[model samples]
Target chain A: MQHKPIHIIIVDDHPMVIEGLKTLLSDDKRVLIKNQFMNGTDTLTYLEHNSADIVLLDVNLPDINGVEMVPKILNIRANIGVIGLSTYSEPSIINQMIKKGVKGYLLKNVTGEELVNAITQVHQGDFYFGSEVQKILADSVTQESNDQPKLTRREKHILTLIAEGKTTNNIAEELFISPLTVETHRRNLMQKLEVPNAASLIKVAVEKHLI
Target chain B: MQHKPIHIIIVDDHPMVIEGLKTLLSDDKRVLIKNQFMNGTDTLTYLEHNSADIVLLDVNLPDINGVEMVPKILNIRANIGVIGLSTYSEPSIINQMIKKGVKGYLLKNVTGEELVNAITQVHQGDFYFGSEVQKILADSVTQESNDQPKLTRREKHILTLIAEGKTTNNIAEELFISPLTVETHRRNLMQKLEVPNAASLIKVAVEKHLI
Candidate 1:
């Protein structure tokens, strides 16, 4: 079960984060702190002549952006598994980092045990996103693909008026249109939005953010 | 200056966080961790008879919310200084914690040095909000008090139309209102929003999230 320790370089702008990670991973003896950097430029410079098994990269760096640093790091050392470390788990940023080729992502509040687990898993060439990250990813997918029903400009205006509890006659008077035309628009809105009545139409419109 | 160690108890559900905190503060002789709890209920029970100078409380607890735990802990021990800790520094949550009588606030990514400073300051009856926290507080203040100009329903609708680059006549045709009435609405939008022209109106409207 024993093997050579996973040499990992910590790339973060915060000194305490590096120290904390070093302290957290120290006792395990499975991962060794090969080096540390305060910014992306220095980390990339260090990586040019040296090599490590993994790079624990931070999202915020003074010299270089974390998302951009991933491909650059891989461009220099393709075998080094890059695990992103950040204080926040923004879905767009995580997705961008993944697209640029990070092996794992972790929130900075990571426990010592999970840090070691992530390092071990990534060292084994398997992708690992922490539980919170996975949850955020799942939430983003559900939220983005929620199928927001589209409505036209006039339909949107009518929807807003309907949400305001306007009668068809009142809406016709306000828009200077015939009451029959207003009722037709209302019926079209219900059909387009797949709702049964005015109440459901307004509810679905709000849910889909059409108004 | 040598003095009696500040007896403190940590309330966090994560064991590794407790261990990491213990490791961080162990080197400092000025503080002593009396005990640790995985939830708020046990911490409160422990404080019923036993006393600690401070409680390093996490925001998320299985049994009790971190903000609610503050007053509860102080109900049992009024003199205990509670320092709120969390992975994220949500402005409203931080503001609520402050309003609830937390003496200090620190992000869980706190450095050992800042952590000791927070404990010492809170122990001495002074407030200590970490630098990142101060920035977020400042941002929330600027964001909330930005003096958003409230617009009525029709005004908001006109604002959206203007943002879509619709001319006064075009909007008049669409809304079935006279061009002169549309012109008055456009001018009213500019004056009410305090912008000089349509471009500025759209810019401010977007900034204020009116459209």
Candidate 2:
């Protein structure tokens, strides 16, 4: 029985680097290199005719940027995942890629094994961050986490429901509580958050990953 | 004196599409087509040796989804802008692109004039969203904005400083207010957001974009 192959395309401008990647990745039968490109334009063109499981793209392209191609590529095929391969460990780039919905990011200096692992992780729909990238993300999280507020159980429950897009009346009904109680909880939340409306509440929930 | 031509590359699998794009863009003496490729691999490879000011990429490529390519291209060139060309308008894709720092997105069916405008805007470090895209983004903003919290001005200012990593003492010092007042503001913010700790407070702040 043949196993399903993970089709991949390596997009970079260097022939030597491409050849090295191919050689390093050659032994894995499950990973097949579908095609290669030297720039963003050609990759976009090829994508019109073909599809792959993953794309390993360098950020610095000769004619265009790799980061900018993400949306256009996804518009063509929503299912394909991209793993940003880069030489620099810039925080801005890492943050941008995460926001862009990249499944994984690997430094160009990573070992072949790590690269393969990153591709597989992304294919499985899990997020993967390089070691350096993780530190960058953690720094932000740490600074922010220090001051996090504690939630009362009732408030926590209310916030959860709110994040789930529940109406106040619905929450009251579900909790077998008075509408006034729900209102009080909401009021408390507003005072604590100093926000003015439900939209901001939801926004905060999403940002803090409270939901 | 003649202005320097903006270097460009077109990457798509369709020869006809490449030709059409070239013809349309070439009319401007300020634009130059450095090369064209049918795949991401070659485009990436060529970028190693050459450089361009912009890359006009199709959202769909036969090898990989275009959305996935944005960060990959950006990793290679920090300065080169990208204009994503797509046939559809997807909220997630657009949101993803924005996070990845794409300069602009253009539907494939857009007018040549619009395309020209998109490139120019992206090259100048401004953002361009096609008309339909603008509506989608506006809708998201509207939806998000509706959740605005009803915090007092003092609460809002305190929340802002808190989100920016200010301590109660620091905030009080900056505002020329008592630390007790800052704590009161913070406590009020927590009650409003319904989060119990400083960590959750910042989280809510980020979610609501209150900061």
Candidate 3:
């Protein structure tokens, strides 16, 4: 018995990219190109009547960008899986697409087999992350946000207490550290940041993603 | 006729936050608290059988950070709506969560009425963003990625042509610039970047996000 083919819509501005994808995906029996669009507006227009199992969306569309289009597509149909295809590796774009409910994240230069696998996995209700995509996700998770003090575990605990409006002496006594050490941390932070005061240093720490 | 109440889950380590959310949401007849988890791992466990229509997710989860857990929750159920609730306003984290398929992005200081509105909007398949969240999204779109060169539109067009192996004479002709001006730009770039050669300059420029 044969299974139903995976219907897909390709949305991109470049004719060469669409042509290339058609050529690459033509040989797969499980896949069928339902429609192709040159821009986000066209894709949305097509979605008014037609819905595909998966969508190959380019983030840098000429009209509406891929990140902006994710929500619009989901609004049309929540289950229509999107696989983002882009050349740039910016974390912001990647994160935006992911939050917009994209099931597969891949670079434009993805191997044919990987592309096929990603579509299949997403179709089967599993996420597909290319190696670089995974690295970007991990980096986002591990990297400290720009605001907040870059604190070690102990330092973080100290910061929490500080943010809670605790005094250095009280914090030091509570955390079993010397008041001199607390003063030392304060001094070190000021020196490293070249700030004049603790309040200003905290502001800097919050602004720089140092936390 | 009445609709089924929205099932909700609250994930945060802070007892105060849980109590506050409960207090805020309890009076609303449309919302029903399904479960509350202290961390990402517990939230993951609860999702095994119990499904929630909305989840109030905190970025600073005790076991796994919310940025990491956003994917995990989406992986569990692509349709479940997640609203990020955190004290942190770091663009990176907010952007990361948005990419991970959150339906609403709100700060921890959100009022009860606002939270209810967000949850209702998300449940009805609409995106929601607080004023600050909207500002963050707008700022993120404008904020240049550190990896890419921050070139003016003309410079980027020129650089793109150069990256495509265009000669200075060819680029000058295409961009309608004098050869002397091209040389001037080349020299200025070298001086500002402290690169020895054009090839090195292009490489460094691309690397530094300076187009």
How much is A204 displaced in model 1, in angstroms?
17
Candidate with more favorable, higher lDDT: 1 or 2 = 1
Per-residue CA lDDT of model 3 for A1-211, tens digit only, reads: 9999999999876554565566667779999999998889989988989889999998877789787899999999888989999854666568767877899898765666787899999999999988978887788668733223345666555544554446789879997989988877767666665565443444344334343
Give the Cα error of residue B15 in candidate 2, in Å: 37
Question: 1 or 2: which has the higher DockQ?
Answer: 1
**How does each model score on TM-score?**
0.62, 0.35, 0.39
Better of 2 and 3 by DockQ: 2
| Poorest lDDT segment (10 consecutive residues) of candidate 2 chain A | A142-151
- Clash number for candidate 1: 0
lDDT of each: 0.83, 0.73, 0.74
Off by over 4 Å in 1: A13-16, A60-64, A86-91, A107-111, A131-211, B13-19, B60-63, B86-91, B108-110, B131-211
Q: Native contacts recovered, in order, as a fraction for each?
A: 0.09, 0.01, 0.00
Say what the RMSD of model 3 is.
22.8
Interface RMSD over true interface Cα atoms for each candidate:
12.4, 14.0, 24.4
- Index of the highest-DockQ prediction: 1
Q: What ranking of all candidate models by lDDT puts the best one first?
A: 1, 3, 2
Clashes of each: 0, 119, 18
TM-score of chain B of 3: 0.68
